[model samples]
Target chain A: MILKRVFLNRLSGTWMLITLVIILSLPLVIGIALYLKASPIFESQSLYQLIVSTDWSPCNGNFGFWPFIFSSLYVTVLSFLFAAPICLFAAIYLTQFSSKRLIQLMHPVIDILAGIPSVIYGMWGIIIIVPFVSDVLAPLINIKSSGYSILAGGIVLAVMCIPYMLNMLIETFNTVPIGLKEASLSLGATSWESVKHVVIKKSYPGIISSFGLGIAKAFGETLAVMMVVGNMVQLSFNPFEAGYPLPALIANNYGEMLSIPMYDSALMFAAFILLVVVLVINLVFRYFIHKTQSQ
Target chain B: MNKQKEIEELFFKFLSGFATYSLIAILGFIIIIIFVKGFGALSLDMIIKTPKGGYYYGGEGGVLNAIVGSLYIAFGATFIAILIGIPAALYINVHLVRYKRIQNTIRYFLDALWGIPSIVYGAFGFTLMLFLGMNASLLAGIITVAFLITPIIIRTFDEVLSTIPKGLHEASLALGSTRTEMAFKVMFKQGFSGFITAVLLAFGRGIGDAASILFTAGYTDLIPTHLDEPAATLPLAIFFQLSSPIPEVRERAYAAAAILTIIILIISLTARGFSKKYSKSNLK
Candidate 1:
């Protein structure tokens, strides 16, 4: 029995170690595979060439990613434009003026929004947002209704991102000391003045980190954006124009990529680019969270 | 100046308050649209039978294949995730608790893991499958999802485990118990409900996500009978239907979304209920 106990304990320890190894090494395996599969194309093309060129046609062996990259940036920026103020002020209101009851009520709603599948968000966008934009929104902006455009993608992304942004910002806002708010109020600063000058100022770094996280999320979204983003290869400043971002580019073409020469490598290259950008953002977000937590 | 400050305060106050409260309108609007449009699309066959005769092209049949596939992948992934996640959570909190920097470093990796996009996982899984010479299959989907949720499970479970009073751990150690024993018997007991909550949370995330499994799982017309075969999932179902040129099939996308939403709602509510019950009993 004693020997059995000893063996069991040792087995348990081994199991934990094995789990650790598996989790830690999965990323390495993925990274290496991405590098290997993408290197042939990488060797042929310079980073500068890839970033500057605008064409991405497989028939011509051209895989310029500038359009995809700019589309991603445009939509991400637009999503933040829609999401930031609403999320910021709402988070401020939530932490400052909201009652406990209201907070409790909002928790499940936000969780529900967060819990809803991304594709469902896509579904919603297709049914409601897409039509509204095509019929009403685009016409308002004097563009023909394409029903799928950067504006549609951006709006859907904002809804999807709001839950995450609010979660992060609310936590940051909550950490602002009550004493500071009280001190501001005692000095005759109004609630808005105190919140604007004190709470938001104090939590600016955290807010920026949260936005970084949101950008990572916005950049990586695939199914929802793919549905509404009207996956075309184009570089234009018009939000009404249909465009392809990196995730959409990868998703739309990865299946038939092997059918075309170098297409597999090109799509793999896209995935590699996305992974690097997102990882950097995530690392920045982690640093910000750690800094705030330490403070 | 005083009057201006007062006016500005009230204006900003109402604006911020409007921003805060507008979430209700937005959420309600989204859910209402799903229901109003999706209601016509739901039918008896949707829940019970597999798609028949090119349903993606607007034919007869249901999403039974996708439903089962999603369950198989999510449950399978969660099982693997729990096996690794619980052990990892306990290890970091127990074995490496004294080394705060190491723990934080480990946690930061996990955080980054969670933050990586589902599509990246899909792409990564696609690559991994190619390396193994494996076709897209239920097994591949499960493995990818296992990677997807490991960080979520670990982090949520860690939050619960970390909140356990230090006295409990010290007490267990004073009794000459091994840290492993303390983890399972004492800390596990204290964090039992949280484990449940964390599992459900991960499962909800797993089932809801389509991007990670999109390439790894591969769509099929029939329910997955074996882990070696490709399996369909609800999110992919919605995607296929929405992409179909047929308006009827397109409408079916909303029905699929409605069904997916209901499943997630049930999971969230159940998780909350169990956690609430445990919290009440945990008042001591």
Candidate 2:
């Protein structure tokens, strides 16, 4: 019985070790694979040459990534523009002025928005949003009717990102002590003035970090942007133009690259870049969280 | 003074009202669009029929295979993640590995793992499967998802385990329990529901993910009878059908979207309910 107990004890320890290795090693292995694949593309061909070339046709020898990079950045910026102000004010309102009943109603709605699958987001975008944009939004902008454009994709991504930002910022804002707000109010500051000057200012770091996380989510978004971004390679600022961001580019072509190793390698290179971008943003948020707690 | 106070109160009320209404409107609009399109495309065959090449129309097909495939992959991945992630959480928090820097680096890598785009994981999985000469197997897809979701489990598990009062562990040790016994019987015993909640969160995330499986799972019309074959998932079905020129395929896509949304909603609600129950019971 003693021997059996010892064996069982050892087995449990080994099981934990095995699980640790599996969880930690998989991404590490992938990170290494990405570096190995990416070095040649960047080293043999200069980084500037690879990125700045406007043409992205993989069928020929051209491997420019400027368009894709710009599109990703553009969409992220536009989405943040739409979501940030509304979410920030909403966070302020939720934390300060809202009643219990209103807070109760708003919380689940945000949770549901956050919980809905990205593909469903995509489905909604393609069916209702794309048409609305093509008919109403496109005509207003005086562009030809292409339902799948950056504007449509950015608007969808903006809505998707708002819940995340609002949730994080609401928590941040709530953590601002009520005592500070009351003291400021008693000292002749209006509620709006107290909120604008003190509460929002105090939570600015958390708010920025939360918005950074939102941008990260937008930057890494795949399905919604993929379906509605129109998948064009042009480098125009026009929101009506179709575009290909990194995730969209990777998703659209990875399946059909049956035989071309170079094409596969280039896509792998893009994936490596995307992984780095995501990792950096996540680390920043972690740092910000650690910093806030330490403070 | 009374008039000024009344005016200020009215202004605050107006501001709050408008802000809350807009936030609610955003969510309301999303749900409306999702269901309107989702319901418009729903059909009976969509739940049962499989996919075919060329026009996904004029044939009896359902998402039976996709639904099953998503569950299989989600379950398989969560099983692997829990098996690995929970212990790692304990080890990091309790074991205090001899090499703190190495352990810290691993923890950071896991954090980064959460942020790594699903497509990158898919590509990584594709490469790993190629190395093993297992082309697009269900096992490969599960591995990809398991890697994708491991950080979530670890974070939640660590938070839950950390919140257990140190007194409990000390009491367990005072009672002559060994360190392992204290961890398993004392610390982990209290955190079981939280652990399950963490696993369920990972399960929901794994199932909702479409990008990681796009390349690793590939596409197969046949329902996966075994883990060796390629399988279609609900997300992939929605992706392909939305792009299809056929009206019939589009309708099926909406049904699949609705089903996927409903599944996610149920998982989320379950997790929320479990946490609420735990909080309530502990208060008494």
Candidate 3:
């Protein structure tokens, strides 16, 4: 009986290891498959041309990704600009200043905020943000266009990513030793002084990674941004101008991709780029988290 | 100099307070908007009947198909996720506990996977479907969602398992139990509540997701009777309804969002309740 049990453990353990290996290899395998499938059809065009050219005309075989790439960075950067200060302040408030009761109350709220669906965010963006941008904000700024613009996308993306950024920043702030903060206070530093001097300095690495995580989320976000980004394939920096990001382009167009020549290849390349960039950002973010954790 | 320092301190303090309250205000406003905008448009028929015509131009019928479809896809995906997630988590905690390097590497990959956006997973699934000569169906959506939520489940549950004292494991081993036995019989008790929380969190995530299912789960008015049949979901339903040029259809989108929010609220509340209950009866 004991021998049988021991053998079962070995068998199951081997199976578990095999499963682990397969799960780890899935991304690489999919990436290679996507690359192979993409490379053949785009063989006529240089990869450089495809990446650098601003044109996205599938009929003309101009599969340049410059517009989409720039648009993604533009909107993601705009979101960071809008979201970073509030999230940092909120984290500082919760970690350094809030009472225990307030902390207990606020933690669940943050978690619930994190749990809300991205698509509901799209609904909110459509109902509230779109018209506010087009009718009110844009007119105030003397810009004229549809409600769905890069600015709208950036605003909605900021809201969508705030909870995640707050969670990370708060966790980072909580990691600061109580002794350090108390010592700063004992040396004639006010509460804000300690936060500004010791807390912020100690947690800068985590805060940066939190920002990276937020940027990655906005960069890769599709549905909500798709609802608001207006999906105009263009290379523009004007916040009011309509634009398309890579994920939004794929989301909106992939259904009809079979009919368009070289469309699939172009789209595949975009996905690959997004996947790789997101993976790299997350790896760096994890490095920060791991470093802090080990300390 | 003293006045300037005091003013600076007050300014920073006010800024932090304003930021926190702004978050609270935003949450309040979103909830109010959904309920108020959705109240008049929310009809019992929408919950009980499928759209009679197409889901365009403010058409008739309810989101019965979508509600049913959403539940099916989420539950199906959760079932698959839990099966693989729990065992994989068990493997890491029990089998690989001695090999810190291998465990960290595995965790590193999972975190990376978690960070990969749902849309990328959708694109990857779409590509894989094309390669397999299979069309979009409920099965495809479920599989995609399962892949999407696995990392979440494993990571959350892994944290739970990690909370168990090291002495408990040592004690179990000293009592002539194998690692597998110890995992299932000893550590599992302490982690079961957390396991529930992990699955619920993944379920909430799976149901609310629209991107991963956009292409894979082809829309249908009927509740899916087979795995191959296309199915409607609440998020996609809201997306399509809100896209309509008609004002009435747009209002229905708010109603759908309200429903989605309520379900998630219930899940989170129930999770808190579960934690309270389990902690009271905790072994440690």
Candidate 4:
């Protein structure tokens, strides 16, 4: 019985270790698989040409990702611009100024917002933001848009990102030692001054990481952005113009990809670009966070 | 100068408050719009019947196929995630208790995996499907979503397990229990509610995700009776239906969204409630 029990323990231990190795290698496996799938496009075109050229015709087997890359960057940056200030201010209000009761109440609100599926967000974007952008905002700016623009995508993405970024910011602010804030307060600084100088300063790394994570998220968002961004492949910096982001391009073209030569490769390459960008963003921010915390 | 500083503080405070309220208002707007628009089209028929002929063209039918398919995929994925995640989390906390470096390395990998977008998983799953000579089906969707949510499950369960005091580990081993026994018997029992919460949370995510299953889980009108059969998901249903030029079909999309939203809301609230109730009972 003793020998049997010992052997079973050993077996379970091996099982656990094997599972651990599998889990650990998953990201690498995914990266390699995507690279292999996307290698055909790389072989077909020079890396610079693939990324810098605007030609996207799949029938003639010419693929360039410049427009999609530009769109993803523009939308992500614009959404960050839209969401960061609001998230920062709202997080400050919740953590610094609000009572515990209010913070508690906001938890579920943020959770629900974050939990709502991207498709619902897309539907909401189509129903509300599209019309408002085309009829109201575009008219106000004297620009005619088809209601499906990068601006609409940005607004919807900003709303979707707000809860995520705010959650992180609130946690970051809350991590600021209360005594530090109190010390600033006792030094004749006003409450806002204490928060501005102490809390924000102390959590600066956290705020940066949160924004980085949020940008990574916004960059790879597919369905909602796909629904509103009009899927138009264009090299335009105009937020009111319809542009196809990388993930949107993949999601939109994957169905018909098998029917066309090099189409699947192009789409796979797009997915590869998304995965690498998001992973790099996460790694940088995580390293920043780890360095600050270690200090 | 002091008065100016005070005014500035109040003005900034007001701005912050405005920002906070606007976020809340946006949440309120999302819920209200979904429910109000969906309520008109929601019906017993919508929930109970599968899409009939011409359903995408505003024909009479429901999204029963998608609903059932979603539940099947989510439940299957959650089950797989639990099977892998629980053991993995337990192994990290119990078996490798002394190896902090390895634990952190493993955690870093999990975090990276967690950060990977679901679309990438969908793409990866598609590649895997092609390599394996498999068609898009319920099993493909389940496996794909399992990949997407397993990191979530492990991370959440790891957090819960980490919260248990260090003393429990030593105490259990002191009683001469093996690591596997201690993990399955002591730690698992203590964190059982948390395990439920983690599984539910993962299920909620799995069910709501559309991108991960978009290519792998081929859509069909009929409920999938076999693992290899195509399965429709609610999110994809809403996606397809909302894009239809037909008004009725678009309304059905809202109804589907509302249903998905309500399911997610319930899962999250239940997870919250479980965590709150059991967190107190666990040993500090």
Candidate 5:
């Protein structure tokens, strides 16, 4: 009976370890797979030329990713500008000034916002934000726009990211010890002063990491941003212009990629870029989080 | 000097409050808009009947195909995730309890995996299918989505398992139970409710996701009858329908969104309820 128990234990342990190995290597496998598939494009054009050129005539075999890359950066940065301050302040309010009951009430709201599918957010963007931008905001700013501009995408992306960023910021602030806050209060600091000085100072790494995570999320968001971001391949700095983001490029063209030479590879290269950038962002932030926690 | 500080504090406080309320308002607005627009287009026929010809041009039939397809994909993916995730999480927290560094490293990898965008997964899955001489189908989507949600399930379950007291492990081992036996019998029982919550959360994510399955799961108008058959999902359904210029098709998109939202809401609330009940039981 004892021998049987030992054998059974060994059997399950081996099974569990196999799964652990699979989980550990999954990211590496994906990264390698994407890189291999994308290598075909490199045979035709230098990586620098592919990324920097403005021409994007897929029919002519010229693939320039500059426009899509720029658009993605513009939309992501704009959304960060729109969302960061609000998320920071709201997180502060929830953690420092609000009652526990109020925080509890906000949980469901955050969950629902986070739970809504990206496509639904895209649909909402089409029905509301697109028209609002084209009719109201664009005219007020003296711009000719089709409403499917970087600004509309940024607004929609900002709202989608708020719940995610705010949740992280709130968790970060909660980790600031009560004793530290009380220490500031005892020194005759005002409540806001204590929060700004003690709580914020202590959780600075956490705040930066949360923002990093939020940027990574905004950068990779596809469906909603694709729906509203005009999907036009153009090199434009103007927020009111329709621009194509990298993910949007991939999502829009993957269906017909096989018909064109190097098109599938080009799209795969786009996915590779997204995968690398997101993983790097996550790795940097994870390192920061790990360093802080260990200290 | 004091007056300046007071004014600054008051202004910052007001800003914080404004931001908080605005966020709440946005959530409320989104929910209201989806329901209000979707209600008009929703009907029993829409829920029960598959789309007939001319559905995209706003003729007849319903998104029953999408509804059934989404359920099938979500269920299949979640089952696979749970199968892989539970064992991996259990191994980390139970079998590898002595190796804190290894546990944290594994967790770090999981976090990075969680942050990878679903669209990347779709692209990768497409490439994988091509290499394997496979076509887009239900099985392809299920495999892709399983990869997407497994990290979520493992991380959530790992977190819950970590909360189990160390003493219980010691006590179980003292009773001459093997480590594997203790992990499966003792620790698993203790964290069972949390495990359920984790599975439900992963299911919610899998069901709501569109990007990961977009390329792998070729869209069709019919419910998939076999693993090799192409399947339509609610999010893709909404995407295709909404993109149509026809007003009627667009309205149906809203209805589909509302239905998807309702299903997600149910899953999330149920998970919360389970966690709460588990916590209450612990308090006893």
Candidate 6:
């Protein structure tokens, strides 16, 4: 009986081992397949020509990614510029200065906000934000059209990114030792002084990490941008009018493809580039988090 | 000295009070805006009926289809992810007898996968699905979301398995139980709650995802009768409706967003509740 039981155990163990092997090997297999498929197509296309091409007329053979790339960076940078200061202040207010009860209340609220779908954010941008931008902020920003310009998209993106930034900053600030802040306060420093001299200094790495994550999150976003970005597929420095990002371009056009290898290859390269960019940003953030935690 | 100290204490208390209230005000404004903008659009028909083509409002268009698609895709993603992720996690945890270096390398890849942006996953899945010629299929969306959910479940299961005390496994083995039975019956039983939480976490993430599904889950108005067809999901529905120029569609968008928000809220809160309950029950 014991021998039979042992045999059954071994059988199950073997089954599980094989399952594990398959699971662990899937990504590697998928990666190899992707690289093999991408390499042959990319070998013929000059990277410089592809990057500089202004025309995205896939139907007519133009597949320039420069406009889309520039638009992505432009809107992402603008949104980060708008979001960083407000989020920094909010994080400081929550962590260094807010009372425990307030922190408890605010944290869940922000969590819920963070949980809200990006799709809703797009709706909010159109119904509440676009008009405000078009009628009000557009004139101030000196853009003629407030309806679908960079300014509108940037503001909406900033709002979408704020919760992410706030969450990261709050977590980072909480990691700062309370005793350090108390020590600064005990030394006749004001609350703000303590935050500046002790808390901020200690949490700077995390704060920077949050900034990088915020930028990456904004840059990689698709649906929210798709709704507000107007899918113009053109390159423009102005905030208003239509523009496209790589992810948005793929999201809007993936369904329209006629199974062309060039189109597929373009998308693969774009995905790879976006993946690399996001990984680089996240690695920077991870390094900061590690460095700060070690200290 | 006492008076000066008291004055300083009073000043600090006031400052803390002021700062705390302001933080509350900031978070409060965000919730208030969502509720104010979204609440009025809620209706019974909106919750139950399907949108009648192009006419987004007042035509008894219901969120029933989207609700089902969200659940279907999320569950599909969770199923595939668990099937793959749990074994990998278990192997990494228990069965890594040789090539520890290779195992660790794979483990690091999973960690990196966890941090990869959802949009990139969307793009990758979009391109891959297109290449596979399964354009706009729910299965493609499911696979995409599965890719997104993999690292999360693996991490959760791996951590849960590692945290289970070794004594349980040892005792099972002493009783003549095989390594597989000991791992599955004893360790898995101990880790069941955490495992459930991991699944719930994956489900919650799958449901919350928008970018990853946008391309693969190609938006369709009609109800999905099969897995091969393009189906509308709550996120995609919300996106299209909100972006619609029609006021009725906009209203439906609000209702949809509100519904989605509520569902996600429930899932997230439930997942958190399960973790707490399981941990507490285990302690008792």
The top-ranked prediction according to DockQ is 5
Reference-based TM-score, model 6: 0.83
Each prediction's TM-score versus the true structure: 0.97, 0.92, 0.97, 0.98, 0.99, 0.83
Candidate 4 lDDT, tens digit per residue, A143-206? 9999899999999999989988898888788888899999999999999999889999999999
The best candidate by lDDT is: 5
| lDDT of candidate 6 over B6-117, digit per residue (tens) | 6765665555555445545644654566567678888887877777764664465688888888888999999998887776676666666356566555555565566676
Q: After superposition, how far is residue B96 of candidate 6 from its true place, in Å?
A: 6.5
How many clashing residue pairs are found in candidate 3?
1
Over 4 Å off, model 2:
A1-18, A21-27, B1-17, B40-43, B49-55, B97-110
**Total clashing residue pairs per candidate?**
0, 4, 1, 0, 0, 7
Tens digits of per-residue lDDT, candidate 1, B1-284, equal 98998899888888888998898789898889888888888998888878888776778888888899999999999999999999988887777778889888888887887888888888888988988999999999999998999989988888888888888889988997776788788888998888999999999999999888988999898788898999999998888878778898887787888888899999988988888889677624
DockQ of the candidate models in sequence = 0.74, 0.52, 0.66, 0.76, 0.82, 0.38
Question: How big is the positional error of residue A285 in model 5, measured in Å on the Cα after superposition?
Answer: 0.5
Q: Rank the candidates by DockQ, best first.
A: 5, 4, 1, 3, 2, 6
Candidate 1 runs further than 4 Å off? A1-3
Could you give candidate 1's per-residue lDDT for residues A31-84 as a string of tens digits? 777878888886767878887888778778887999999999999999989999
Per-residue CA lDDT of model 5 for A82-131, tens digit only, reads 99999999999999998888888898888888888899899889989999
| Clash-forming residue pairs, model 1 | none
Quote fnat for model 1.
0.68
In terms of docking quality, model 6 is acceptable
TM-score of chain B of 4: 0.97
lDDT (Cα, 0-100) at B51 in candidate 2: 58
Query: Which of the predicted structures, 5 or 6, would earn the higher TM-score when compared with the native?
Result: 5
Chain B alone, TM-score of each model?
Answer: 0.96, 0.87, 0.95, 0.97, 0.97, 0.86
Candidate 4 ranges beyond 4 A from true positions: none
* Model 3 chain B weakest 10-residue run by lDDT: B53-62
Candidates 2 and 6 compared: the better one by DockQ is 2
> Which window of ten consecutive residues has the lowest lDDT sum in model 1 chain B?
B275-284
In DockQ, how does model 2 score against the reference complex? 0.52
